[model samples]
Target: MEKDAFAQQLPVEKYTRNIENKSIFYVIRKEGDLTKPNFIVSYAWGNYRNDLVMTMFGRLMLLMVGLIVISWLPCLGIARYFTRPLVQMERHVGRMAERDWHEPISTSRKDEIGRLAKAIESMRQRLVRQDRAQQFFLQHTSHELKTPVMVIRSYAQSIQDGVYPKGTLNESVGVIMKEGERLRYRRPEIKWEMDLAPHTTLIGDQEQWKIALENMLDNQLRYAKSCIRIVVKSQSLDNENAVKGQTSLSKFCISNDGPLLDQAIADSLFEPFRSGGDGQFGLGLAIVKQIMDHHGMTVRAANQRDGVSFYIEPGKQTDKTSVPKVS
Candidate 1:
């Protein structure tokens, strides 16, 4: 790969962006390979002389000089309005390379730069959505398996207490044992909720949705103290969802009594490979972000007067109902 990349960087005899308005293949052969003969030749597949690059060298150089002039101190100040955003974007990528996404690329432009800014903002939001979804998935997955596990724990103790005879209990009791084993290795727990409004069934990978929801519930159950609340409400104009132009949504929140994490720490919660808080791979939230990105949703964290809360906000639906569950 490095060799291929370096080969592309080799000084061009002549380089010109003003090629034929069509794409053509550029073929190169190994040095001194005499499959046919030893000759220096080049060709093009589009109209216009293939030698245009060679002749246009002067114009290209002038363009370069013109750019240099345009970037001079006085001109630079004026150009900063356009170039600043791109420079920020480049810096943003560098931060992203270091596994940072909390800082967004900033821009104040109404042209092409604005479009790029919008794109980056959209990407940031999508990423946030994915992270939240992932956290929920892993948490629920761990939670779902707990019930059968507890059953086994209970019955095993019962058998030791001689609560039921061995002959009469072997069949159904054996089933419980099998289920315990199945759940023992599973991560997270399973939780369910139902509401009458009937959040219109969304067309999606049903399996993925179930896993994600379960993971969220698991996270809540694990972190929550006594009570956790979840509310699936219509995407309403009264909420921030309206600002983002969201129509229908499934908002899942898990409020806990635990001390709210500072923004600096909480911001890092969804990052992959980041284990910021106790009992956390940090991949769960990352996965949630990915799933939410695919589904066009948003997630946010806030500290309420009573406790800390995290919300999953979904968008995209004209009219729909919601099914919410609370624990």
Candidate 2:
């Protein structure tokens, strides 16, 4: 192109030109005097653009590869950190399903996973305890049942052989009847003297309460001489026995004119299969204790001057009161 045509078309600095259907990038500058002459420097724009695009694309790919390499280890570590506990929990649950409760579950983490592990461990411990208790109960029940069965069989055999085991036919038959009563789980007849307050409010499962009461009365009647006194009254909670946010509670007291219990026997009286030196099934007091504990109530037995007394009272006060009616 002519110099005047370049001056007319191109400005100072960089400019684009098309020649022979090819893009060209050029720059112009004055050689000597600012207004006298200018020189042009030019290069192919399409080739430069292609090279620049390829350089950027190569750098971008290299950066992405570096980022992936750097992130792989941490991502794997994070996945294992979360999945390790889940795998352990899955094994523990499988063991539990197989009824293998000997192995204890444990986790030291303080997150939600740790809390779940603690709860599962608690459940496993409870299952272990219950299994042991059931086995013990079955063993004791078989032994207890065996004794009464053997006595009845021996006495009947003696009667069939025209032999009097207790020295006379009447006495032998009475022995058989008493043994039958033992098998029948009969409680001895006693006069019930109740002094329950009017409108006394005791809240719990009705059927469970009935079972607990029956078991308690059976235990008391076995040792009682003639009278069993049941008293239901309301009493204010003392500081020691006071539950939070409670002012009063209802008390149930049952007393029997029975022989005093030994301190050791009295201490563990409510434990399962604890016999009181008598040939008796000792599950009654234990049943009462279970019922009381389920209802958040407390039961205690103490030796009185001439008898034994059992007191059952709520551990927490119900808002409903058991105030005696003013007559």
Candidate 3:
């Protein structure tokens, strides 16, 4: 048929043909010589196509199974690699929550997990330091309170036994009263004059600033003879760059008509548990200093002409001469 005609005309060796809408493959090979007869083989294309599809499908299945089997251990190892640090971190955080900050988080990997571990370790160190400091503060506070309490108790006991510890009933009672006063909380008299500028605003923690201001006022009231003055005003600052114009800054000054502070006392005024002119060691001024430092503000005491003055302002300027007077 068409194959025979093609073979006779062109000496076909191999070819595919469509007959009656069915594909077939033919192969012809020379046998002995030009005159000798040749061999011809033919097969239905459907059989070859089916065999090819089956072979390819089997190989593809085998390859996929091999790949999965080869990668199984590696996949598991990678999963553990990522999850192990997370599990350790979870346990560490749990311990930290329970206030156990003894162990340190350690990691050598230069990745996100490493950074997280370092940060947690830093936080743990800070918490440890804070806890130690709190303990120290409590110990000192208890000691300070215990002295007055013991004094009061002893004086009261002596009076109850009909004995004057201070040589007289009134004197002994006065000693008790003095010790009791140390433990008593009294409201301020609020007799100081305030010259606050209208709409004056300062950027700081309100409650902390209140504590600091109250501590300062309490200190002044304890020493002031009669008059105390508070002044709040906004001062204009000339910017080094003219294009930036000027910035307004708030200044606070409190003055009391009290005895001048000794240079030694003024130098260590903000130190914790330091005794003031009244021979009373307290944390009030120390708390004020801490609050001011935390808010990035500056506070300084200066011996004014007639009394003592405290200046609270922003920035690192500690020179009293830099502050403007609002008299």
Cα lDDT tens digits for candidate 2, 233-270: 86544445345543333788999998888998889889
Better of 2 and 3 by lDDT: 3
What TM-score fits each model? 0.37, 0.53, 0.55
Which lDDT tens digits does candidate 3 get at residues 184-224?
44546545788987545444566887899889988887788
lDDT digits (tens) for residues 1-327 of candidate 1: 224323443322322333457644443333443343222324354444556775698789999999888779777787986787788888876776675777766666789878987897788776765666566657766687677777777777777787753455786488576876674323233343333233333324556566666656655655655556666655433433333543334565666665666777578765665543554454556676666565656666677876677777775542222422211
Clashes of each: 28, 0, 0
Off by over 4 Å in 2: 1-14, 25-44, 153-173, 182-192, 196-213, 219-228, 231-327
Off by over 4 Å in 1: 1-199, 235-250, 315-327
Q: Cα miss at 202, model 3 (Å)? A: 13
The true-structure Cα RMSD of candidate 2 reads 10.3
lDDT score for residue 313 of model 2: 86
TM-score-sorted candidate list, best first: 3, 2, 1
Model 3 C-alpha lDDT versus the unseen true structure: 0.77
